[model samples]
Target: MSDAPEDLDAWVVTLADTLGLGADEHPIGLLLDLTRDAAHGVTRPAGPLTTYLVGLAVAQGMTVEDAAARTRATIAEWKTEPSEPA
Candidate 1:
């Protein structure tokens, strides 16, 4: 119920069970890292969006680990590229 770090594991498990998702299919640490990377390297909004896309990719048969890896790679590439003016 609380957004505390200590509550994350239980929250993830409960949410996963509620959505009929398997924990094995969604690694929390990897997803969190990807979110952080996307948010910092790309855009703040990209954090949740990237995570959502990763979930969609997994739902479409991609492994979570692979999705995370691909997402991280893309974020890395984005970081290397110059940003366009707002």
Candidate 2:
């Protein structure tokens, strides 16, 4: 229900801080912004596109190990290259 973009941004920043990810510069800040968008219902249809998914999951009360595993699975799905059956 927190769809306001500004609120999303703030939430993301605070999350980054809580995780010690520190959204004060490039890369990390951008990723945090992306996570905020996800929480606000924005999504990349193909799948999770960044570590933001991991961070956001952690922020959502998921256990660290569970979030890490889910994040890894999402990343693997995104990175899987199409293969031709030999």
Screening candidate 2 with a backbone cut-off below 3 angstroms (N, C-alpha, C), the clashing residue pairs are none
lDDT of every predicted structure (CA atoms): 0.86, 0.55
Count of clashing pairs, candidate 2: 0
- Summarize candidate 2's per-residue lDDT along 1-86 as a digit string, tens digits: 77786787787688769979777633444455445444333345423444545656666898656765565454445446533447
For model 1, residues 1-86, the per-residue Cα lDDT tens digits are 58886699888888999988766444778888888999999989999999999989988999888998898888888889955667
Model 1 quality (TM-score): 0.80
* TM-score against truth, every candidate: 0.80, 0.35
